[model samples]
Target: MIEESGRVVSIEEGAVWVETLRRSTCSACSANAGCGQGLMEKLGVGQRRGYVRALTDLQLAVGDGVVIGIREDLLLRSSLQVYLLPLLGLFAGAMLAQWLALPEAFVILLALGGFFAVWWRVRGCSRRGVDDPAMQPVVLRAQLAVCAMPVEDR
Candidate 1:
């Protein structure tokens, strides 16, 4: 499971809206110099806020800290669907156009058409998955709070 800590911002019937700060480890990575992500981070694109609607049965309130998670398999499947499927469609369309001895303009047009078609299919699939429990993030647990000693106690 991929987990992230966030603060609950709101509550719904069966869900909690959590706000999280996005963090990056690119600075600590040895390949930061060679990574495009690192470059993006250097350009001040790393830190940002994100909101997630996570399913939970626990009684939580606004400002309560919690941990939320999603399955690794689900994440992997989504990544492939978002990135690889359209790429495959593009290659398939280009190859088919070439096989048929189509003109350059036709090949480009078919490739773009294939990419958009697969993208549209992916959008539909994502919309349907929104209602699937397996696709939703689950609240793992409440975040632990730390206690500090007062000046008098210390």
Candidate 2:
């Protein structure tokens, strides 16, 4: 359950739209004068993004920073789908090629080419900040982590 904070920019029933800040610790570091991180941060201004999500708590409002987690099950399932689905497609295509008496080398090359093309497309989407939708029943792990902390710490 990775969590990051954003400003609650708006709200609707069971939802809060938030704008996440592009936070880089390098911005405030004394060594920023010598670091590439600061240089990239400066170049990547406006990297911040907005996303709307369901909120059980109605008390939160605009201008308030809220933390959100990319749901774990959704993350895991999406990774599996991205990695495995194309491989399955390649296998099916290869089987057809084999039955059609295509040369073994050609079949193998087809599988490899298909795999690379799919992987490349998925990578491009990920790099562009395109989000995969979450499966239902998102259990909030970060909230549970906070609750499970010992009483003395609280």
lDDT of each: 0.95, 0.65
Give the lDDT of residue 10 in candidate 1. 97
Question: Which segments of candidate 1 are over 4 A away from where they belong?
Answer: 33-45, 151-154
Global Cα lDDT for candidate 2: 0.65
Stretches of candidate 2 off by over 4 Å are 22-42, 103-154
- Distance from true position, residue 36, model 1, in Å? 7.9
Clashes of 1: 0
With a 3 Å backbone cut-off (N, CA, C), the pairs that clash in candidate 2 are 14-55
Worst 10 residues of 2 by lDDT: 136-145
- Residues 1-154 of candidate 1 have per-residue lDDT tens digits of 9999999999998899999999899999999999999999999888899999999999999999999999999999999999999999999889999999999999999999889999999999999999898899999999877879677755
Query: What lDDT tens digits, residue by residue, belong to model 2 across residues 21-91?
Result: 66778878999988887888888863667564644444665666566766776678778868886787688
Model 2 CA lDDT for position 57: 48
